[model samples]
Target: MADVSDPLSLEWGGRPARGAPGPMLAALEPAAHRYRFQQGARRRSSVTYLDTVDRRLRKKGLSLRYESDSDSEVLVASAPDGIDTTELGEAPVWPALAEQLPAGSVADRVGPAMWVRAVAPVVETEVVSREITARNEDDKIVARLHWQEATANGSPTLARVSLDPLRGYAADAERIARLLADSGEFVVPERSLAEVWLRHAADDEVERRPTITAGMRADVAVATALLGFLDAIERNVAGTIDDVDTEFLHDLRVAVRRSRSVLKLTGDALPERLVARGARELKWLGDATTPTRDLDVYLLELDELATRLTVGTRADLDDFATHLHWERTVARRSLVRALQSKRFERWCESWRQSLTEIVSSGGSEQSGSVEELARDRVRVAYKRVLKRANAITPDCPGERVHSLRKRAKELRYLLEMFAPVCDRKPHRAVVKNLKRVQDILGAVQDGEVQSASLRVFAERMLDRRSASAATLLAMGELSAGFAGEQRQARDELTDALPGFLGSSVHKRVTAMLP
Candidate 1:
């Protein structure tokens, strides 16, 4: 973990002697049978350079050596770690790494005595690296360069400076500077950035407005992604607690939420409620993961704050940090135990079975056509909206109204999805009404989130018994402001509901649905 960002003694140009392959080759050949598990190793170090694209001071090229133990081949890059990885995944530059190897050569023999060779194909490796360097205008060391490369063959590789190690830190700074100067200008197009979003959007459209040809394809894609997410969560829960990270947890939660949301919106179109139940299970999983996620967020913020505290406040900060760490440890332990509980495990199995059943069930229900199912969902949501609207008493708080607003929005999204096949004017009118409700409720929800966040911060500060009087006063002021805003938003929502729900536009939209 020591930062490999500084220039290490460079060694290269090693070649394999003409000879028969050894036992390592036999061991690696099986990996080739799997199509993506070729074995290789690399050592890299960097110095200082300017990151031309970011227009910032960055780690420069140091040295990297890749060797295939099975093939006795090597590849070396006198480039920034990021660029070196990028080249492997993308097209080669002039005098490219590819040219350095023999035609059909699987590896490069490089350096004095041909001692090093890059074993993996340039197109099959992913590269991720990061380094810490001094700011261009300040002496302060800060984390700067970070890059991730995912290659065509689905193999991932990562390299990062070990900032906590003193030597690694100095080398990281030197590597950044050297990399900028030595590496040639090579740019990867930004188009790939849209792939995930576009893929999801297309799936959403097909789910919302399925064509005969696209229906099965879209469903399978969505289902597959959902399964992947579920599997990751299951692994995280059943595995060691130390393996969990904030980003991983967040990604898992999002996958679950999106899958549930999509299923809730379109499940009636399927032959059974299996998908619906699966969605409910996902919601349960999300709820189970919430405490650990909240603690993760708190720990991150605490770490950030700790770095900025003065020496005089060190004792108090240490005490608070210890308390937070204890809390996180307990939460993680509880989460792991809960995940292993028979009740939770049974639910997970059932959920997975439901998904498998739905995917296997080939035929659609009577109401399976996209238009019909969309209308049904819209009407169902509308009924809930009406019920909530009717129950809204003057005494109801903003939180309740905000919940209603979400229900209204769901109804509106469904209607809009089917608008192409339905009466557009009526659908648009309903959407407008829904928007009005959403706006009012959204304001209230924002206030609620801010207020809750402030309250949590205040409680943490108080628990540490180190909060300043000024901070306490500010928290009180924030709470009062949020309360006032929440009240105003709730009143606005209530006052608008009568006209909004009873309007001629609303009635017309409801009439057109069925």
Candidate 2:
């Protein structure tokens, strides 16, 4: 694995004048060798850059691209392991899950970072490239120059020249770099071609969370938060309706959930009728979206779930996969209809206008500052969680744990939304403590729900004769996996409760909340 961090060349923004020696290389002063500028190789390749929804790879200082021409198709990674190459039998389809790609070095590199999210083309550039080498008197390659013209749809054409630095020749590379800096006609750019194009393609990037302050009006804060979530929900509607990818629906559901959470906690600050209508409509939207999203989770995890089966071959579950697909397809139709219905569209428009009006009006004077109101809510919500946690017994049924989980989640949301007013260190420590326990609770709920749902799915498959006896038995094993996982989480939760709601964390939360 190679870790190459330095840029191979000093790239300037524009092409040089035609039929003329470019300004920078013309000024290179070779100490001991005569310079030779001759054309080397020319090729045209289609290049596409890829990233996850959150730009995970780019954040890690890595870049992945697919370059294809007549002779070969390859994945080029400018990654921590230097420049890595993985050959592909054919070009990959965009929005491909990591598992869909062939198992190799590239897949191993990117799969874990991508997690459940799909990797898709962030930008595509058609590049016409030609290389020119700078040779010394010994015919040794001291340096190389690249002339490239890249263009993408709805973006300005990129025409640049770069000097490729040679190893053990820092002086020569420095000479070229200085000459380029001195030239008035050429200047360096801060961002790479991939970064520029990704920005160009992302036309609808909006901040998902609202900015709130302690001294801000309670009604304005609530309105601002709700409005932001409304935009996110509206933004994802088209992608969800079109079934572009699972994340579209996932994001939509998150926005819907956050909106519900905010209103449930702080709806007292907003108009009563408006709050009532918004809650009703958002709940409807959530219910309408539940079926397909649940199936999507199962389908996404089916491959890994199959591997957990000890009694049946993975192929035995092929019918199970097919059944999930058919169910997702059918569920998706209902989801699309609900999103496109007249009621949904009308509610979106009305909600936006109403919230915008409130934001513009600086909110009603009846509501107090967010600091005072949220402080009370935060204290009450924390005590609620503590009370619920204290009531849970190991022998208690799952419902007690579920009830506690709900209270903990509500407290979590309040802490997150009001974090701006809290002391940074203690706020962070408190949230970390809460998340540690939340993960276990979430796992328990998921395992319980999935195990029960798998049994129902198996019953359906048997009734419809859609699955063989082998497939059903394999499902039984998978269900047992989920049940075992649920049991493990319950045991883990027993140990986590004291650490989360104990005296140390209690004091930290009290000191941190506004």
Candidate 3:
């Protein structure tokens, strides 16, 4: 491979139908006696780009694609100062090879993030090009250029010049760049080809949580933040219903949960009637998706779960895997039905319209200044967590920790919403404290759920008489392990409670509030 520093690209646009690369190259071609120019026949082909649904590869300054009529894929990575390395692979989907390419370089990145994401053509382009090499008197190649015309899907055609200079010929590359820039009315474009392609190919907007501006009215800012989440719920419905990807369902559930949290955190600042209605509908959505999501999690972790048993015992889990697959199919069908029903449609529409009205409403009785409201909510939530934390003894049931976890989550949400208004340093400290409590609580809760779920699944398998006794035995072992872990997590929570609800954390919460 040649040094990345030796190549330069000069891009420019022309009337979609009217430019000839020959004329551009002619301007730079030298007198026959002084130098030699060899031009290859123009070759035309299409190029298709591959990337994750989120555009992760492009974000890393990498262009990954397979050219039409070609058997290999190429990844072109660019860095600062006009340096780039292009790696080619024989496989069309190159995750395995890319993970190991040029160790410690950017080329070796992104294979892990691509897990569960299908790499498909997000954009396509047509190119007509010719390669020209300039050789000196001794026939040693001094420089090379690839001049091409590229047309992105539904975009205007454009001209491009790629210059590759031999070592010690950096000045020659610069001169070639100038010659290309001067051709016709060539000028640098404000956007890259990838940007243009992405713009044209982009689907609907992906909703992002809004950041509240400081000093904004409490009701207005809270309403805006909640609306951002509402938008996500609405945007994700079609994708989730269509089963485009697991992420769609996951993101939809998150939006619904966050919306419910916002209403709870704000308390009476939002109208009572509005909060009650939204909470009821959001709860329905959450419950409706639970079975499917649970099944998704189990199915996704099946292989890892299988590895937990000894090699011989692992084969006994085949029946269990089959049962999970059947369950997922049933759960997914029910989820899809709910998502597509008229009731769900009406609920989403009503939720959005009602929230929008609330956000736009004139000064109302329940509304208060944001800072005062935030302080009241934060202080109240913090007190509840502390009270719950104090009630738990070392021997308390895991359910107690789970309840405290819920309270801790509520407090965390409150702090997050008020972060822009509160003292940043203390607000972060308060949040950090709450998160530690939540993490331990989460682990305990998850273990309980998993262990209970496994027991139920194992019984169903036994009742059906579909699984061998070995399968039941393996499941029992797994359940015991989960129960033990759950107990350990409860112990951890008990030990960590003091620092979490202690005076230092109390002071941080007090200092955080406006």
TM-score, each model? 0.45, 0.82, 0.78
| Span of ten consecutive residues with least summed lDDT in model 2 | 1-10
Candidate with top lDDT is: 2
lDDT of 2 by residue, 371-403 (tens): 777788888888988888887666678898898
What lDDT is obtained when candidate 2 is compared to the true structure?
A: 0.78
Task: Give the per-residue lDDT digits (tens) of candidate 3, residues 156-271.
Answer: 77666677789987676676566556664455455555555665676323324455666656677777778788777777776667665566688788887777788887846766
Q: Give lDDT: candidate 1, residue 89.
A: 33
Kindly report which residue stretches of model 1 are placed more than 4 angstroms away from their true locations once superposed.
1-151, 154-248, 254-280, 294-329, 336-350, 364-368, 386-395, 409-442, 449-471, 491-514
Sort by TM-score, top down from the best: 2, 3, 1
In terms of TM-score, which candidate is stronger, 1 or 3?
3
lDDT agreement with native, every candidate: 0.48, 0.78, 0.70
User: Which residue ranges in model 2 land beyond 4 Å of their true spot?
Assistant: 1-8, 11-48, 66-75, 84-93, 99-109, 121-132, 135-141, 147-161, 165-175, 178-210
lDDT of 1 at 25: 34
lDDT of 1 by residue, 56-156 (tens): 11122233333222223333333333322212332232222233443332222122212211122212232322222233233444333332222223322
RMSD of each: 16.8, 4.3, 5.6
